[model samples]
Target: MKFLFIAQRKLVILRNQDFKDINPERQIEITRHFGPIHIHPTSGECQGGSPSSR
Candidate 1:
């Protein structure tokens, strides 16, 4: 069995704008969609993967 994990940095851009930070609403939306994104520092040691046929 294989589980797909996607990892990417979170960023916010303001083109030709004067905003110093991302909008709260947009941040919330992003978090809602892509939040809880975690990674297994050690692939086999992490508990995120499926059970193996030991």
Candidate 2:
């Protein structure tokens, strides 16, 4: 699986093949430290609504 992080107008990509090895709760905990996050689809569209703040 792939995760994209947008911080300070820069993009960072995180890729992991073993998705089950990572805990979902821990992922959320770590991502929240980066401030607000906008989750986009692999297609790179923002969809609707606003970005979520941590």
Error of 1 at 44 (Å): 39
RMSD of 2: 8.8
What candidate 1 gets wrong by more than 4 Å, as runs, is: 1-20, 35-54
Best by TM-score: 2
lDDT of 1 by residue, 15-43 (tens): 69643476544544454565554435565
Local distance difference test scores for all models: 0.43, 0.53
Query: Candidate 2's residue-wise lDDT over 1-54, tens digit each?
Result: 223335454766568645465565555566678766557655353334233432
Model 2, residue 29: displacement in angstroms? 0.6
TM-score of each: 0.25, 0.36
Model 1 residue 30 distance off true place after TM-score fit, in angstroms: 0.2
TM-score of 2: 0.36
Model 1: weakest 10-residue lDDT segment is 1-10
